[model samples]
Target: IAVMTVLLIVVGLTACGKSTAQDLQSNKWYPNQKGQSYKTQFNKKTMIIESPLMNVNANYSVSNTSGKEYLKVNTDDEKNQKLELTQISDGYKAKAINKPAKADDGLGSFE
Candidate 1:
């Protein structure tokens, strides 16, 4: 009698778990679109010469331009820059605008 009771309890729990999972899967959550803009700040001091060592503030905006969707990122720092990324098949792609030239290692080869 105890073994039968334990088996019934286990079966009930399994059914409850499956039902909860299905309910969660049927309901999808999406972000709010009421002109919401996300902002982020970063301050870092790096020993590596390749990395930037400064305080930076970035703002992200999502909107549609000319019927195409884009994610815009604006940064305020030494190199004040703006980037607009467009969604591609595999990932996003953005053109490098107003970028500085690569430094040469004095041997005509880029470092």
Candidate 2:
């Protein structure tokens, strides 16, 4: 009887976890992860989310279309500073043209 009860509890927990995961997936902020459609672009290669918390994430990608490689931008990115792409020889690389973050400017600045 005890073993059966434990198994039932485990199954219930698993079901709850799955439901929570589904809820997160329904959120608009969540990244689109459907069939290689998670491509995103940003002006600084890093996006700063204001609400909830100060979250930062980098988004970029490159793909060849009709013998021409094109860089795509994320719709969630800000409209003020549109992400620009530059072509290179072989493949694509994300480059940082802006100065480094002031918080990380110095090694001992935190001290």
Candidate 3:
């Protein structure tokens, strides 16, 4: 019984440890802020920002620093732009970090 219990616990923890990359690839993400008309689709290492005007491509990565997770989006004009997310009922509320200000900080919701 002891061995079985330990095995179950290990399995449960492993299942809950889903990588952010896997979550990003699951669905297209929408913005939760105002005046932003773009959605994002994620590949293995890239994010496609789809807008009415044009589609922009960028690289992205997920990292954990000091027990907090951050999503880093890199574009032509920006590099290693970090966003901290708080999980809500339906999605994540993103806040821009390591910046003075941001207009793109919003919720990352999937449909």
Candidate 4:
């Protein structure tokens, strides 16, 4: 019974898709800063980021640790832009995950 239940749960989760992806995809992520004109779209294995600072197609992966979601982005110009993002009342709170750089600067609860 326990094994069946676990299998069912796993199957359901897989069929529904990863919650992190769904949550990330539901909203059009953008920088909170005004006048910057930034828009980001998250897909299964990639994302499109458009802003004055950078405009490029990037590959990304979502992972959860300690109940926190971290997004890793890799662009042609940059690699492994990791960010620990938490959903806030207004937007999202984000910070550098590992080695900080310009790529991780684009995330936060600014708007």
**Against the unseen true structure, what C-alpha lDDT does each candidate score?**
0.34, 0.34, 0.70, 0.70
In terms of TM-score, the best-performing candidate is 3
TM-score of each: 0.29, 0.23, 0.74, 0.64
TM-score of 3: 0.74
**Candidate 2 off by > 4 Å:** 19-21, 30-111
lDDT of 1 by residue, 1-111 (tens): 999999999999986763322322343322112332222221221111111343333444444568654333343322323234454444344333333211121101010
Error of 2 at 36 (Å): 14
lDDT of 3 by residue, 16-70 (tens): 9867678778977876455554687889998898878878787888787897877
Q: Name the regions of candidate 3 deviating beyond 4 angstroms.
A: 1-4, 7-12, 35-37, 100-111
Better of 2 and 4 by TM-score: 4
CA lDDT, candidate 3, residue 20: 69
| lDDT for 41 (candidate 2) | 26
lDDT at position 101, candidate 2: 15
Give the distance in Å from residue 12's predicted Cα in candidate 3 to where it truly belongs. 4.4
